[model samples]
Target: MRGNRVNPNKPSLYLPCETRNREFEAKLLLACHAAERGWRGVVGAKKAIDQRIARLPRGLYISKSITRRNRFILDIGKRLGHIVTAWDEEGLVFASPEIYRTTKVGATTLTIPEKLFAWGEANATAWRNHPAFNGTPISITGNPRADLLRPELRDYFADEARSLRRHHGDFILINTNFSLVNHFLPGKSLYRQMLQAKKQPISQYGSINGLALHKVKLFQHFIEMAQAVAQRFPWHKLIIRPHPSENLDTWRGIMAGHSNVAIIYSGNVAAWLLATRALIHNGCTTGVESFLLERPAIAYQPVVSEDYDSQLPNTLSLRVSDLNTLYMHIDNLLQGNTSGQETLLKKCHAHACQHIASFDGKSACERILDSLEPTKSLLLDRKKPPLVDQIIGWTAAESRRLFKRTQLVRRTTTDSTGYQQHIFPAVSQSQVETYLQRFSTLLNRFHDLQVDDLGDCIFALSKQ
Candidate 1:
């Protein structure tokens, strides 16, 4: 059966975003690029996409990740006659290729996506060498997320950074990425949940447990570092931005009694990195972003584990192994003494070049759209699924929607909708338009793009 019909003459591109602050603006920029190329770009929350996938018009679906957990969505999209492609958002800054492939890339799910996009040479090499890889043709186009960090696009976040600096003056931004152990959901640690879902076998439990233990140690060190910073610099604010999936209450509880410390998990992190005097993180993706933005990135590694620590981000940062050294580095950075930053960045630049393509000339978004252009006709000409299969898919989607509603109602305090909203708040068409306007002002492009509300926090962008 035919799915919901759009403008058949205009091919559609579906982009599902799991995290708003991280993926929304980047995907929106990508959508604008797609619209410029005369294709309809539908960008939405992942939940919305999952609920409406079967009903939406057949299109090229770009999945955020290809983990085993995403198999259902991949299968459904293929069964509904949509061309599938994917790039892992968490693949670039990983512990090791072996561990990353084991935990993030699903052996079976890797075969589903017809094409794959890589962040850089390292990512492409890892995926190409995977046992499940079947000559799927991996494109080494850097992520659109990295596109936002390019100098040309830095102006897009200028206003937000200014406002942040005004509200929180000269703050030390501490970005934590420990949701695997400190998840907002009560019994739902990401590692544990993956195990429960059989994403990895029982034999892998020891490795998972060890990684969790390492993260827990790092989590505790971060808390201590925050406390120390608060004590050391009572005049300046210490902002602790937890991971979206982390428990904000836990951070608040530990950081209580510190008047200078604020537990904030709002807005895009690029703004925070721009506004802060220096960014403090261990192995977060934000560390690399800060380096890209020419900000002082401090990797506080009080408790280090070579096996568990992500190399790229930390390597790109100014590593400090103790609280005293962290304080000294912060002091120097605050005093505008960047004597060693240039030297460190120079060394890290050669390493980062292997892992990330910063789009010195053409943007990553443009490159990705260009890559998709050659396959557009083939994707558009594919036949629709059989009527019976479409019916089955629709029924399954409806059942999932009903089950989700029920689960939402049954969730307790820690596992409630509050956590989901924290990660992906309700988005409006106005917000999308505002971002589009910002993009237009920055690049003098996307002026012809128009936003259409597609409901369920989804928006479609196309040329007016």
Candidate 2:
């Protein structure tokens, strides 16, 4: 965050916590890419990121909102000598923070078509440009989710596709689920609610128990659309599958009334798609893979969000609230009217996806695995502030908490159960202040902190 620059003539944005978090996240992304010193660069980047992200709990999921996470960031950043501060001025253009690559990997194919691959490109470049990424072994792996698409794995699903087509008698398949709405919903918050529900004895959705109002509304809209589509195409089977994490029995109990309408078992979503003549989805990247399978697909966007900057080839969205629109598309299909089919569809697919996975799914897995090679990479700074500090700021309790969380700071637990106490590390505090003060004086003396290249510092240090 020390190196961050302020832009003139830009309206400062103090959005809702979640939206502001997104904007901060988008800023400071330039430092995340390091080709060689991956972890080190990443740490340096996050230290800077933390300085900014420390401002918001807006998007932090409540269940995961334990003090431990903030402590974790503080401990890690402190140990790594990462900076923790906020900007004196916020900018209009989104300043992205560099994301820390944890051991967690995106196992689903969703990461690829969702423009995560392109995010890799941008992040990798950030690392390279970062003073931190220099000599780092880390580089972007493209899309880690593509690992399932390699040649060795290609045949794994081929037989399933063949078998499904043989039995289904030319069906139209859709992979539907609440996860399908991941785009519009905040992943950091809503997903945690779902996860928390699964973890705890209770079942809740986004601060509410038993199907959050938003999810209920989502279900209602889908049901109306599905029933309408079923009524129009009496001959076609209407199959719906909720996410694996969901116990759709509740939704199924409601759907039991529709004779033409049906729900799919968890394991069968992919198989059903392979057997189907067409695929229908909403903002799901599976549409790209479905097209590669040579099954034409439909993208349904009942709502749009800001996450669409990265798009794919051969993907088109149809926004509809009811069956009337679906009926029209079905009617067109029945009439052999695949209008604008060739040019817009095929060309867009080719144009949008430059990677081999665009035409062949195999490239995804290969690129992803190759990227996880344990090489060092210096990534851009995604410094986000400690979460609690963002929530409470410099309040007495929060300040005491933040004060104790610092690694270099010593603490004395006076209250134990009541309120833990802290004692600051004079050495660390004085050292930082002294270092900054000297750095500023030196910068004034020399006009900047630069050596000829990596180190013209020996002479400078010796001179001092």
Candidate 3:
């Protein structure tokens, strides 16, 4: 549950959910884990932080996006004497080649939060070398999301997984990341937009890398290959799970009247991973996620290029060049064949260890909390700003809130520009209490922090 309307008096941890996917769950679990350890905080969507920033106290506010808007918010938070932290939800998925170079990337300047919690050593080293983060404080805390994927916590979603198995029965999950192609318009219009992007400056949205143009074709190939596989194995169920950012209607339209092929976009990926016999994808995060769950995955690359191939999960998964190859692997797995799988599995395990942080089924949140112990007194010693400073912070926070409400603020994604919006399912006060109560042993530590319910989309950690 969100913390009671930002109470400046009580110290709390603020975790903003950038997107409602596995990352959201991971962060939520962190908040719950925090509560267990006597920390009080609210987990809300990114917009929720801005809406209630005025009442927010001088404590830590955590975020995931690397956008300018978030950087602006952090700037404002600092002005009001609050600690801000950030981490990439997609940190391990893509390599920003520019981060390797001495010169800063031209796309956008890095927004170095007061504390930047990186996922692993590789990410930490990249940020450490970057010019913008010259003096920024950084900690290589393993991602909390990966903590949930640990085999021990599998019981948390066991009931949901059982329901999924009953509903989808021996299905093959095919995950797609064609959000760039299917989010807004169809192929021709989308291509035109891509051309327009190329003409524009190399901002975050418009890239010279040609990933969008290449992805458009890649999406088409995925669709064609999915259909081919479905046709060949009509007896078996093929579940096509589109990326959350993608347009579900487009996938539904493509697979209309196909009984064996079902396009589903509901439920968390973890449950689906458990329900499936095997997983298939091009180069999406789900491949790595499924790998963590001990599921076999095949990367279908009909048209491959050295420049375009994904290095992490894509390379790690068993690569199948065409539909025939994909069909062969899937058929073999379905029939319970694992004779020649040891070497590839070993490589995937090694890659995950090298790339991802701790996966020992323990709370990474604990490690993060230990890092904040030195600053815990700062949380306790929060002082009210001078009256004039309070007035200025309130005025600025309200102005930003109004600008966002009126759609006056511009938002941009990797390949598009618009007002980005997301809403998390609100948890009730009772629900929050019940969740915290489940981990009562941890809650016994913090005698000062308590949960406060601020009505109408706001909740917080408040001083008891």
Candidate 4:
């Protein structure tokens, strides 16, 4: 979608898509809102973030993947005189060692972003004090994605949630976070590596490789827990929502012959959270989301340790250490007996409010836009890209697309019965407008800005 009457000379707001489309939808919705405020906005494909920045007028560009590996994008944005901000999409709960690894943190510290917007105080504090981001500016702006599930926007997904309930019926959501077994390398090889890495004696625990091995073992335990739940609750409907990075075929195989379980992967968690009887996970951000949505969240950690059990979700969610405890809690929730968890819910609310940023739903996005407002007049006007440069960009994009297609074809040929990939669906113009209209107050408050549909994911630009 595009903006109407956006002056070519005016500064623009550029948001790049992520590998997962829902992640990018957060930025797309923000772009729409920005357009309504008389700010020029552009949503670029993930692969063409650099190309879009190079061709467009200098403005603010927000990207989720501004790691040291892709620091070249930071350099390009700098050379072009654009303000680039890197926000963490994964949040703080699952802090990857890569963030602190010398390869990633050391190289991009100075060039990445002038400021990094974190999920909350906890995340902001962690990133600020990290050896990698020692001197970087970090703000505790609640993630915009979480805003989609806030109370103010609860009605936004009401229809979708109702539809999901009608189709899937009342069910408990089992959100999985075992990407190592279900997403990354071949499951057999990955499992072998995990076993090998875990063979180190207890003294080696917490080491770089040990940390990963611990994670892999956790994934294995998570799957076993799921199996136990399925067996114990044969009458109840269980909806297993695998991580977007997961392979669904593995889940399908695990759930085979279990008519009581269904596997789903796409769509926002808010709808699913709203529809479910309870949200069950080990160490996932969905529990935080479920807490915000006023849903019962149970963190099942059958195999726990200090290094792994200390996640924010584990702290906020009701702790269920064994299959029996999980079943008891889930059964109580299904039977409408939540009086016992009052203290736990209160703690979750307090922690959420303190660390998850804005619960009102509007502040996070507004704060982001407010930060970029000052840059409107500071943009440097440059001549459009030469035809040769444009040609090269287009050629490069096409080549990457072809290469990905070839890889997909090869994978399908090699293992036709393997796990099928589910792509995140795109948000249509109608969907964007529907959600944008929910912010009527913001739209009316900024009547000078207007948005229009520009096909091909590029929009026209103008101010007033």
Which candidate number would show the highest lDDT if scored against the true structure? Answer: 1
TM-score of each candidate?
Answer: 0.93, 0.43, 0.83, 0.82
Candidate 4 per-residue lDDT over residues 1-464, each given as its tens digit: 23545576656777776543356556755775576666677764554455455556667777675456457666556555667787767654663433233213434543468777877787676565555554766667777787676666677678888998898776888988766555633543343466666555344223445455666777778778777877887777889988766677788997797888888876777888888887888778887777777777898877776643437777778887877888899889889776645676665566777677776545677777676666565554444445665555456545544554455445433122122234333445566555455554433443344555554344432335
Candidate 2, superposed: residue stretches over 4 Å from native: 1-138, 144-156, 179-218, 268-270, 305-322, 332-341, 354-362, 365-464
lDDT of 1 by residue, 114-144 (tens): 9999888999988988888899988888899
Q: List the residue pairs that clash in candidate 4.
A: 2-459, 5-462, 6-461, 6-462, 7-462, 38-449
Candidate 4, residue 245: Cα displacement in angstroms equals: 0.8
Worst-scoring 10-residue span by lDDT in model 4 = 412-421
- Per-residue lDDT tens digits of candidate 2, residues 150-176? 333344345666876575555555555
Flag the better candidate by TM-score, 1 or 4.
1
List all candidate RMSDs to the true structure: 3.7, 19.2, 4.6, 4.8
- Cα misplacement distance, residue 395 of candidate 1 (Å): 3.7
TM-score of 2: 0.43
Question: What's the alpha carbon RMSD for model 1?
Answer: 3.7
lDDT of 1 at 354: 78
The positional error of residue 123 in candidate 1, measured at the CA in angstroms, is: 1.4
- State each candidate's clash count: 0, 58, 8, 6
What is the descending TM-score order? 1, 3, 4, 2
Ranking by lDDT: 1, 3, 4, 2
Question: Residue by residue across 174-265, what tens digits does model 3's lDDT show?
Answer: 99977657762344335436655665535643343455556767888988888887888888899998876666778888988678999887
